[model samples]
Target: MPEATEDLARRGDRAFLAIGIAVALWLVATVIVLPIVMPDGPSQAVTDYLGALRDGDVDAAYDAAGAERHDADAYDTSFLRSEALSTDWRIQSVWTSDDLSPYDAKLTGGIEPEGHETQPGVRVVNAVISHGDATSRGQFYVQETGSRDFILNPFVYADAGATLGFVDLNGVTSPAHRADNGDKLTKKDSFALFPGFYRLYQHNDDLFRADPSTLMVLPGTDVDISTSLSLTDKGNKAAAKAVRAQLDTCEKSTQLAPSDCPFNPLDDGAADSVDAYDHEYRDVKDIKWKVLVAPKFDIEPRDGEGPGDFELVPRNYATIRLTAVGVDIYSDSDKAKRFSTVCPIDPEDLVLTVTASKSFTVSGPAHTYAGRACGRDH
Candidate 1:
């Protein structure tokens, strides 16, 4: 009877061991193997979306997030696929709608979602994405199409506006247009962009420059980045050169009042009698003009204008000496005499327009005496 009891006890031990092994096998399959084979959850959807961006795979990122691509000709997408967007990024944590706060869940109200609707099986995934020293917390809506498969909704885009007419994204010239926010249109020129790190600048750095601004785009949030452009050192130098060249062209003219020239010998009252000078000085042989002091001026950007628009504001008057060999009509002498006169030119603001090829066109100031002749020597 004792030997029978020992056999039963051994059999019982073997049965317990077999049951323990079965449980261990089940746990392994449930914990590790099933996750690999089954469809991804909401957290994985968010992870994949961010991962695609970090890899500089813009198409993959947009596909993973189910976001529609804007018309390539209409929107600027060069920065989204450039190397500037490739940065070290990681996902800190992801939470579902139940774990989010009321304010967090409603973050999508500002930006219009692509095609997502609040319904059953729709889950909002909140993730914390970290890049370098910056951390962005964003929310994404995912809908369950299958039992375990979740499709991430579209992400948010940004509109970049500039005080200048146009703005550059990562050194590419992007033409700006009026932004349509689904309700109304904006007054400023806007460029549609994807969610990523962008460098806001101007490609025409020789004429103008802005402080390089770093724009971080987050999900479910619309960003408007505005930058102010000012003239650069090179621009000032170019303006000075243009002003001097214009003045030189004016000096070459033999007329006392050159067309479109800031300096003129005839004042407003005497301007009408200028035509009589040529008849009066018909006996005179040659007329010469010499600039005494060059005009002193400063360059400034035109207010409420494009990047290429500028003005040369005069700081001081320019003195010009006119010399001629003519009969002195005041003395009633027909004999030729050397006549000399000095006129101080009050230079007005000169409009400077720069072209895309960096060529400068300087338009002289408007004067009352333009095209009028200088009367006989006073």
Candidate 2:
């Protein structure tokens, strides 16, 4: 009986050893294979793209994009370059993970805890070294939600200066748009830059068109918006009449070319109207207040100017002064000037918090626009 027990014990030990070895082999196989089976997503794309961008191979980076993003003829340099449209910037952080959202994966680092602010055109990495630096700056989400891609903005864009048709960001050299034309500009050809900052008057005219911040400030005249918008205040009755006329004319003029830009006439059909584009998605009238660009920025007047393509571009100059005015949805308390240091193109950034006494008073909105909007028309 003792001999039989010893034999059984040896056999059991052998079985245990075999089982352990099999498990070890399986574990090693998994270690070797799991990664091979996993999907490559935003992080991979972001890292590869960032590498290319850092190396200044924009064409290579552009090629790696998805189909819609890859369509070169339609989504060309201008589309990619116009992202510099926003000069104001902020950085937010998040954790480092192989599993990040497709949109969020385009970041090279983790999100940040404290945010850092800088002027619009500075790059993300350099912005960190600016006036108010931050730390542990993780993944960046432009706004509160995990959406807005801070890096894609012009500040981080590898070729923003090139996109602007300038050799660099400084003002020393004329932009390629200007240089290519032999510096000989025609009457109609001029440049239109989306404002570094601005506001849109609800009743300044018939149509509450906000795309071209100031409809036609005309060239050679330094029309301080701070003063001009202020002087033009009419009571509700006057405002209503003007709104009706402008709407009627806009609607009528727009009929000639449904494809023409409803506003911001590039060619005939670039309908860049904030109201017209968003007419169906959200009711423009339902919006509580019209935006007023705060006075910290300048817009060179665009009088006697027309559309521009690769050729004749309009050049406007502006210097931002930290001042703001209110867009009174309720009353015309003051109207002595054409523009006032009231309402800002971006309300959330800075509008006098103490400007008004009540919530019903003229405070900025959750968001504002100094941008051109286009879409599936309502």
Candidate 3:
């Protein structure tokens, strides 16, 4: 009887060992193998969309997000593949819930068509995403088509407005007339974009530049992005050189008042009119001028104008030495006398127009003497 009990006990031990092996195999299949063969769920859809953007695959991203594609000619879609797209991103967490009402207040804040109620068979997938130094939480509504397969709701996008008139997105020039979403963008126009990261800046490297401004678009949100352009080190040097070249050209002229130049011998405060100054110097001859001090410029954009339109204003007066041989009209002498005087020129406004071809033109109104200057030799 004791031997029989020992046999039964051994059988029981073997049975338990067999059942443990079965459970282990089942766990491995459910945890590892099932996901490989199954279709993507709501969370996977969001993952695919963000991955496509990082890879610069616009078509894949559009398909993943179910967003409509606009014509390339009509819309400025080059930003999709631009280098400005942020690749430093990671998914912190993804949570799925059938009750979307809890997320409504946060996700739909500042968005149009507000106050959305919960729907049946739709799951709200909330993801915490981070890029560089910024992190944001966004929600996407997805519904299962079949089994694990799911599709994101259509027209799920965000709006981005900018304060700048003309801007460059990811090195691609985006003019003020057209937007990235095929809309005619005016001063108040906004771009409808998918959830992603974008960079805004000015592309005029020779004359103007701005720090790269970043925009993070969260789903169902209206965000504003802005950046102020300032003269680059290269641009400042170029502007100074151009102004000096213009002054040199003016100094080479033999006329008392060089046309389109910033300097002249006429005393603006003393002379009543340009005509009167011309009459006073009608008999002047052998006129020569030299730039004593070249004017310095502060490069800035013209008010209410787009990029490539700049105004160069002198911060200080420019001095010029003038020498001429003219008759002494006040002395009633017909004999010509050598006259030498110094005049300070005021270049308050100089227009510098930059074209698309990267060529620039500098022009200014003819400037008269800023301070008192004696017409006779000093």
Candidate 4:
């Protein structure tokens, strides 16, 4: 009886040991073999692409993204040489469409994998990538080869409502997406841009009449970027009116040089300095303001601020072009005069803060023009 009991115990122990070994083998197969044989999906593809970008291998990243030949090189150069330089970029999440029945709907031509028609597997992956403090999320549409290879299709796109115009953000040009019928620009209201900084007004003489505003295109979201030309028109009209109003003093006053006028910055304390001074050499004549071009506001972000934070800034040397002529002067003697007869006045960098209803407040001395260039008639 004792021997039979011992035999039974030994057989039970062997059975338990065999079960343990089998379980261990199963775990090993699941951990190693399954992963080795399993095919990579869109999530893995996004991970790989982001990994390439993080490593500063922009060429590889662009190839993975299937970007256009023209823009691919430019983006790569921009990323490495100037923008988006970071090594710690990491993928946070990936989202995809799971329905396999209609996988080829989003694929574009040329970049599609060979034999994709036969295999016909495609997926759109939206991935969030972070580097340091900046994070960007984008969509990538990828296609599978009939065999084992995966290729990226260039049709991956984002719809951000409308495009107002292009802005120069931190010296880099980016498009501002806005709503249609803004009536501010001559183009349609659809545009796209990679995440970056932008200025309100671009460098275009034709667009000098445009109001300036700061713009910022952030990552991971779609939004409308629009500004009112009405505000610009209002501010410009008000400012121009204000400046012109000041010049009107010159027209009303019989003095050769009006004390309230801002057309000239230099106060040389000459014979014309005295208001209503009698001049036997020349009588105070007609004064008129001729606006060669209407005023436009170019703005920049305030110090320690982004596109949303802004202040009026001048870019080109000339904002308002005009000829301010003071007629009626005897130029026989070269006597030093505080004001000139028949002088032309031009101003640059006319700074003003635009408010609601097209109103604006000027900065600096109220009586002094921000930029003044006055010369004797030649």
* C-alpha local distance difference test of each model: 0.59, 0.27, 0.57, 0.41
lDDT (10s digit) by residue, model 2, range 114-152: 333332321222112111242212222222223322333
Residue 347 lDDT (model 1): 52
* Model 4 whole-model lDDT (C-alpha atoms): 0.41
How would you encode candidate 1's per-residue C-alpha lDDT over 1-378 as one tens digit per residue? 699999999999999999999999999888986655443477677777777776778788777766556433234454445444635566667666764333333244234333445454566777777756877677776766665534433434445543343445556554444332333434223344444555665456777676545566656665665655567788778867887888888888776566656765453434322233444332444667788878898776665343335666778866766786666545566787666665665555356755545556777644554333443435
The reply for model 2, stretches above 4 Å from the true place, is 1-41, 66-76, 79-378
Clashes of each: 0, 60, 0, 6
**Candidate 1: deviation at residue 266, Å?**
14
Q: After superposition, how far is residue 68 of candidate 1 from its true place, in Å?
A: 3.8
- Candidate 2 lDDT: 0.27
Q: Tens-digit lDDT track for model 4 on 91-142?
A: 6666665643333432232243444344446655666765456555655556
Residue pairs in collision within model 4: 162-178, 162-189, 163-189, 163-190, 169-198, 200-213
Model 3 agreement with the true structure over 208-306: per-residue lDDT tens digits: 664446666656444555445566677667766776677788888876777557655554532321122222333566878877777776877655343
Against the true structure, candidate 3 reaches a TM-score of: 0.53
Clashes of 4: 6
